[model samples]
Target: MFKFRKKKNKNKDSQALGGLDFLSIFMRTLKLLSDFIYVVIILVMMLGAGLGLGYLASQIDSVKVPSKETLVKQVSSVTLVSQMTYADGSLISDVDTDLLRTPVESSAISQNIKNAIISTEDENFESHDGVVPKAVFRALLTSVGGVGETSGGSTLTQQLLKQQILGDDPTFKRKAKEIIYALALERYMSKDEILTAYLNVSPFGRNNKGQNIAGVEEAAQGIFGVSAKDLTIPQAAFIAGLPQSPIVYSPYNSDGSLKDADDLSYGVSRQKDVLYNMYRSGYISKEEYENYKAYDITQDFLSSGVAETTSHDYLYYSVFDEAKDLMYDYLIKRDGVSDQDLKNDETKQAYQDLAEEALKTGGYTVKTTINSTVYNAMQTAAATYGSLLDDSTGEVQMGNVLMDNSTGAILGFVGGRDYNENQNNHAFNSYRSPGSSIKPILAYSVAIDQGLMGSASILSNYPTTFSSGEKIMHDTSEGTAMITLQEALNSSWNIPAYWTYQKLLSEGVDVESYMSKMGYLIDNYNIESLPLGGGIDVSVFQQTNAYQTLANGGVYNEGYMVDSIVDSDGTVIYQHEANPVRVYSAATASIMEELLRGVIKSGTTTSFKSVLTGLNSTLGNADWVGKTGTSNNYVDSWLVVSTPNVTLGSWAGHDDSSAMSTSSGTNNNKYIANLVNMIYQAAPEVIGTSDKFTLDSSVIKSDVLVSTGLKPATVSINGSNVSVSGTTTTSYWAKNGAGNTVYKFAIGGSDSDYQDAWQKILSGK
Candidate 1:
């Protein structure tokens, strides 16, 4: 018993020692944790202190805010479209605000107008500071979620800051700047001063006279025919609702005419909302609101005069419209204004405001390739010629497109007559059938390029029906004979063209696919569509581009108008660079150019030379090439003219598609010829002096019998003259190494035999 008790005591003592050791380790670990916490606290304090010092340092060198007077002067400065000029430094036009702005003090504007704007734009204008925290939070939340529309609860002071101090950039950085600027503006200006500035700079859509109706004074004058102080409650409310969306609720059309009956009542709902807000805000009594709401103000609006400048000359307006579109595209493409981003109302409104400001306040210089001399001549010729086609029922319409063949720069454009009276821009919008003019690009040039046909390749002019059941009639009065491909295009013989198209199809050539590569906008594909410009509709811009490919030696150069865009600060923001894509061989282009020249010499456009000489005797021997086309029932007359330097396309027709009124033996082609003559007559001396066509050496010259479709003699040399006995013609062939240099294929013979011959020719066996 004594030994067992002694052992238990020793074990207990050992356990006690082990417990003490664990306690010591736990205490030490706790102390270490406490020290770590202290270190972390000290580090955090140092970081905070460093941030505070940096902020203080930044505050020490604060940017000086502009004084109220300086701010007002900066905002009120006029912005012109810096100046648009031609390549030759000739003035085209300058864009500026057509409205007359008369700045007024807050007291000068009617109290009703002030209350109406406050109710519509900023409900807490009188109560809130420059920045509304709740609205900013809401906007931030909406932007982050990418859902729901933000109710921008901006105060009037913030709006003023955005327009007068900050710019209309919808970036977050711009928003931050706006807040800072607004706070600074509030310190330097009173509430009345801010309101005055805001009221004087707001855009209220355009007046009936097509003039910008900016500022309260101009708005009152434009919408009510009254001064700002004399505006009625209803008129004030109506004008106040416009700043949110000027275009959607515009009282006038783009042409300065009253909105059509369907859209005349557009702003009624907004006007009612403004009135309700005004009454709720205690600016007007309920009885007054009811009376104003029920007021029939139609007569008041009717009494107002349209601003006198609402009208524009067609040529100037067309060019301006095109330039504006180009500017918008540039901003969208280069500036990253994605269409998805514009879905936000605020972003869209900011863009609209910026565009207006750029027009009225942002000084920018736009340079175009238009030549004033050529433009004037085209206009004059169109006016003189169009008068003859006009009947007592309606007027005739015309469109012209002039491009530099080598450069693809649009030198001149005419959309339509009387832009103010007719706002349709035919030059860009009209998509009429090119008629037979498409024969050169769609049929002849393509046929020649495939090595299936040369300029001297013969196509029977006998009457026939196509495989697609499209019937073609050959005019025997002009003499029924086999026509060369050059003659087929020059004279525009339908039967020969149809045969050429059939042969192309039999050879398994996708004619439409080939033409598309050549930059022809073909909308439909059919066998019959190959001969004439049928089953497709194309614009003058596109037609000129296709022909320019031929002029540019088969390299397609995209047609462009704006050469460069310079901001008011003299920075070049946009410049055009040529991107030429080879669509056809140089040899093929050379041969086609020769054939087109034959057109001017003795084909459908032969009368052009006579017209040119008649217009200007100095141009008597002027070397030019072109083609003429007349649509079914003479609905459209087209002419395309090309010199080595310039290519011009003109069209005359009625917009309604009614048959042209013939002056009892009037040749419709003469209109095209006359217009082209006028354009060439006005060409600069340098153009005539520099214009020269160089033939490609790759084109082999051979004398071939048209009837047999074979070289009569093997020429020992490439350029040596070869003799042909009968029915022989000199042909310039694009050296494509198409074997079996003869096609015994004959039209009006057995179809199986011709097909067999074509199959052999295609295989090059």
Candidate 2:
């Protein structure tokens, strides 16, 4: 019994010791954990601090910080209003409203506006050194946790930085950059200066009038019909709240109409929030806050009917596009921007964005080649006569482009039947087959320029088939006989054009080289119908520019709308430089010009000749040259007319490529002719330079057999040589005796069949 009791007692003692040891170990572990918690907190703080410092130091040297002087200058200056005007200084439009958004000074703004904006946008604007670190920490936690967006903790200064410099990307990296820039900005600008710049640069969305209103001053004026200086407390609260969600709180729709009463709840709700913030900031008392919050802010909004749609919508696009092109050229030529970047679409887009931004905001003064007088007259004439053919089932549309041949500048254009009905710039924006009009340029010019044929060379007008079994048809049934080149062109016959093109192909002529120099790109090569406009196409502007080269004495200049652009600093950034390319010899152009004269004189454009007969009394019978084109099945109609000084190209068709009736095409032609008649009536000086065709001394203008393209061959009628005169015609020939070697091919004769043709010329057959 004693042994058992002693053992039990020892066991109890051992158990008690073990329990004490367990408690001691637990106590040590508890104390160590307590100490490690502090260490962990310290390590986290050190890591965050190290990362923040490293990021700040990394961007510090690279980030450009504005000096106080530069900040003040930026705050004081306003963007210049962009203007586009006629060469005569006639106003086209106040292109933009940079002048209307006049910046209000600190003294000019109301205290209530400052208070409302400060309380709502940044509660501690007056106290912080551009950042609120605690809010930033909360934002970082929220962002890292992915629990919310990254906009939770930006100070007013940081918001300004985001608006002006750092973009508002919802990322921790952007936030860090924003914090850095915000801190730097505070050092270079005062509190009021920062606020002023913010107010001036911030977008305030559209007003009740539905015009894009920006800046605090414009917001106040546009939303409440009150200036920023005169804004009441309610108006101030409303305007101050707009920067948070401008479009959502806007009182108007895109069409300048007032929003629905229910739809306006957002702006009203936002205004109440602004008033509450003001009350919390002690800027307004409870009584004042309630009074202004209950005051109907919508009652102050401007109320009017929807704004009327404006005209000349296409002109703006034309001017802006041409101006951007000129700017791109200037950037490449003057600023030495790398042209290799323009080859890549993405990098080229970057360069384009840069140039476009400058044009939109750089306060550029753009001068255009659009002659207001001539443009207005053409517009009026087109509208009047074009309506004669406009019908319900098929709405006829017309596009006319007039170019100054001397300068290669577009003088005027008739864009469409009505801009509201159709905004497509048919003259410049769309391309269509020019039909037989392609003959004179692609076929005849190649033949003449290559010394293949004279203007009066006889060609077989019989029908031919392509190798692909496509039949070439003629507009009239009289095309089965042999005819001179001038007759074939004037008659708008396709068989003759095909024969000529075949001859050109057989002779190894580089027709595309000639076409390219005239800016006519051959999209379809080796097509037999190319000479008849079956394979190639062009816009009225392009066709006119190409033909203008012929009128410009073989010199080609790319047509441009922008004349001279003066930057806001009064520096001429662009001056229209004539980069003339010689596409053909002056003698060749002269011969082609004379050959084309028959088109208007006695061919398809005979109606235009009647109009010219009237205008000739003023310019001492000014001669006009022109050509007409009709796409297959009358899908498109074209008429191009020119004097030595200017060329006007016209096209008429449906946007959907639907064919019109023959009468409709004729009426379109008549409308185009009338447009030219009115232009000549309005601006006769467009052709005041020269009406007579020119031929260089290197070319001989002589009489030749229309059948043989050679001066009547001498015959042995007597001892003296007698000239055979079966059928004689006048044409320009190379003085070096380079006659058309392909004349035999035109008459369905190859180079081996030359003896039969010479025998006929010798016998006067």
Candidate 3:
């Protein structure tokens, strides 16, 4: 053991030399590996630089970058407020924006606001040329990164381009174009120009009154009652944070009501985020950040104390909504978008957003069909009378729409008594049950047009129900057993309409077609009581237009609010062109007109007939025709009426579908009457047409027996068969002069005995 140990010790120098040799080889291999890694890193950097440059260069050709002059002009151009004019070219209001927008120069804006926005929205605004390459790459991978998770890859230049020019399409092509445009724009405009333009165009959100504010100037003025130049750090911090999520972080709700102190946490929290960014970016020190972080942004949000909409200003929103739809269709066609592409919801929403953006920024002159004189007069009248319909809760409201019978252009309306009190455009928004008012358009006109029934064709008006034992109701407690169609209509008897609907169904006549042509869609056509105004809802606009067809010589012209739209340069972009439909034949219209004329004179709407007579007293002998409706349980009251020149539809109901306090037949008739008088007083030209209704040549009036509603057979002693004067009543017919036998149709608890009962009536045994 001693000898072996000594031998091992003797080889110690050789062991140390061997270890040194191995260490030198290992060091040499490590150096070689380090050099290779260095070369690889350099190559990778070169490759990245080449790819980035090539990517940017490839976009240059695809993107038609505007010239430097155009770019400068676009960024510096003013955003003009669009105008909405009445038919006579007088200003009704300024559209596009609801509140006043104060155009500000860059010098007037507070430096604090600029710094706050810069720190939060785009930290690289000053340092970057156009974009951050690394940020762009990440956005391409995950999302169209905005101001990138913390520092969104999108610079101020890119954001401005995205909002003002390149829309939010969420497409690779759109992102590529956005990058290309941003780079081009940076070369053309100065940093100050880009920042100022961004500040001016950016939407800071709704103010304390819920009015949408676009520029910093309006934001400051409407929110804090201070000028943009006077915004403090806290106010600027709050405003700077709003562009990311305007409505969500706004202090006011959509109804122009201020949010509760507790509900305003989002705005407070977002402001803190802005302050933290400001602190991190060196715009604010740690002490300032901590102080502003504790600042209550909601406390400084002074109430704007301004009305969101004036008495008649609410009409603009409806008009704008309609215009958006029109622009959507127009843009889709102009861009040659295929129908298949529209099935994609994203693509459709992008177009919708584009249309909305154009309306807000296009500086359009929207010519509307409103008659200011009539509108003012009607509004004045409605103020006095509409209060009569308000319930104790002030929840019951009224709506009315007056339309030109010739063109279906909306002439005037009563959306609500006060726009500030309620922003819902009742005339366009509310869809209440139409009740018996639908009888004229749906049941009788279809029956008349189908040649199954005549204006005076007899209907058995006894108590009856459906073949399936469905309950039938009449305006009165009971129905007359044997009544002419004219008398049934005069009384709004539901039994006759029910029988007519059944007959139409048996004969395969489509009542929905006529209703659709008159601008009322029937989603509940299968409802048994649909003929009596059940299972369907209609707005004043729809009811008025439906009646307009009857007065417009059977021509159904779709109702229009906007007559035309002209761009800022006075170039006509859209002109109202009507596509008139022949909803009813001339004979059908004339016969139905004659039938409904008695409705105003002596039937359900007779109470308001005096107003029509008084207003038309000096104009001419033009007749008035109308239909009255009351939904089940008196939840809604409706009057759709027409004169020679115009049609008016009015409704009274609760927003929550609560029953009206008025009884079934007496519903708000006085209000309707007063509105008519006020309309005439405001503008007599509204009902100026003196032309008498002309009946069709095919129609003939004949006297029928009082007992059976049949033409008396060569009576021995009788006066002319002009009307049911004494022993006979007047009747209308196109074939054989209304000599058909009495059908006397009725239904029991079951439909088993209907045919037999009719057969027995025919037999007279």
Candidate 4:
């Protein structure tokens, strides 16, 4: 309703004014036209290039494609076993020279896996005639944009043709030839035949130690330690996801352990993507997809046949398994032997066969971290102790791993009593419950690292209930009310450990993740098993490496057996190089070591002192530390011993988790002690039985009241103040113990009252 006079100006406002700027509009129009012309030019260029490539492909003489019968026949020929050697370049005798392939029928592979592949790689695999036009256009656009070759576009039939008849030349001519051959093959073969061949021939991945893993059968064995028919949804998803990029998604790295965190996360993400694709394609229900989506792929991972006790010497199995995987990866991935080349008539050898030929015929050398003298000692110890415990029942089996504390090098390994009697190598691949031995590494050390307590901090050692209303009590405490961290660990008391874990949990710490930081795989830290070291599984290798972390002042160095590998032509193919990762402070590690020494001095492991004395006088006086763990029903007994230079983790149990005879006069801990003593005696230079831990400067040694965990305090009693002082109670703390406390008490004036009061105060009654 309000009217205003318009002010006149030479400058125009595009929004305020009715008409737009003529020059600006003209420039924008020109820009849009130019952009259109630029796109047109790009299209013209791409079309010309594509037309030229097509013309040249038509002009080229047609190469002879293999017949269907010949293709199928070639798939099963001469899959060879890789060769293995000792560190000294000597060939391991009686090695299984036959090829390693346990082929599974095509129908046996899980439908989830098939659907996963179809969804991820080629969604139109069932309907397309070897290739999809839309996918081809997308790929062509991506390539023309200089984004490199995209993965999708080729149907399963086309992939089969590319793998079988047409080689991987990565040229325009090869691409054209593949298309032609794929079309022809599709006409010759049924859709089911193409899919089956593709599934069988696809390279899923290689395992750790360099073994060539091909086909669904080998892939299933390599990744899950199961046959193809037994593959679960998660396992199948992992395998089906690998053909896109074997090295990138493989659960095991080149060294035969789980991949690093980034790669592992990426691999898991890819698997989930495949699962989601299956879900979108209606191959799985929403509930099934959701359930499987929560599964962690690493939970079921086993590199090749590690879980299988193959018909080979168990002594060399650990390193041999790793070396084989490395050798195969090197031959194909590094040395440039394609799967097609492996299947070619000219090569006459699969990648594994080639690796074997290189070792056997080409004179390649395999090197490892095994210390020969220590290895022999461990072997002898196992045989002697095993025979003593055999009792003709053949139930007792022992596994041990001796590792260098400083270097993380595996010095010696024992799989079982005898390879001929039992094929399962409990040391390398098998997982067992660790029992109370895990206190220092899992619960107590983690608590120490988090600044919750020091060696002398007192924890209520009585039966206590957790937030979940679950109670934990120690068998060794016998109604004791309080104990220092050192005493609890030395005595293997469960209540103190569980209380410490609860403290950590209350502070929002994920104990399972904390244990993983020490290099063990765990899903969740259950309250019931955490303090007692039950409900968790670990291999001897993993357990020993964990103890090595304690001995190395909390620095975790991954344990590796192989040192270096040389090809037949004297080229260094692979090298073992590990950098120590510090997981806890030096003070924490030193405190843990000192506490473990208590186990040797007066706790569960004290019985081995005489055994140490009998082995060598130096060992008796050595500053050694150890812990003993006995599982439920005495099913598993463990003794992990460590000196400055060496650490040995030994497990004695029945293969089927049956009880060992406590009354049979065979003590597993004594046997382990004997083994440790022999290993030290055999390799005194490497082990140094008298070597002692060098405590960090931050690890301040202080005298404290054993019960109260404070600087030895004076108690007012019987009209006189008695000073409670002793050299026996020592504690290691970070810097000066500033925030620590000591319990104060008062007593009545009587001889009996004084005695009773002193007893209550001293004994934490």
Best by lDDT: 3
State the lDDT of candidate 4 residue by residue for 596-714, as single tens digits: 88887774444676676776778778777878887766677788888898888888777777776652223765677678777767877776666788778887666666555666656
Global lDDT of model 4: 0.66
lDDT per residue (tens digit) for residues 387-463 in model 3: 66665545567899999999999999989868877877779998878998988888888777776666667676766
lDDT per residue for candidate 1 within 1-765, as digits (tens), equals 000011212112111112224445445334433633332222223234445423322321132345555655555543344567787877777765565566787788998888899888888776654556566655655656666676674678777766654556665434544554554555556666777788898778877666676788887877677889888889889888888887667677666777765676777677888899899988899999999899765556643344443344555565566556666666555435567767777776666555555544557777888888887887787677756546543677777788888889888877777566667767777888787888777777777778776667767665456666656653333234555677777877777766677777778877876677756666556647546766777778788888888888988888887788787767787788898887767888878888888888784534766666676665546556677776776677777777777777777777887776543113444665566667766875524634666668788677766543556543222244333224556777775422223334343334444444444433443
lDDT of every predicted structure (CA atoms): 0.66, 0.70, 0.72, 0.66
Which clashing pairs does model 2 show? 452-740
Candidate 3 regions exceeding 4 Å error are 1-74, 96-134, 144-151, 171-177, 183-192, 204-317, 324-362, 386-396, 419-424, 468-471, 603-605, 611-616, 654-667, 697-765
User: Which residue ranges in model 4 land beyond 4 Å of their true spot?
Assistant: 1-83, 99-311, 327-364, 390-394, 465-478, 663-666, 701-703, 711-730, 735-759, 762-765
Prediction-by-prediction clash tally: 5, 1, 7, 12
Top of the candidates by TM-score: 2
**lDDT score, candidate 4, position 626:** 79
Ranking by lDDT: 3, 2, 4, 1
Q: What are the RMSD figures for all models against the true structure?
A: 15.6, 15.7, 15.5, 19.3
The total number of steric clashes, by the backbone 3 Å criterion, in model 2 comes to 1
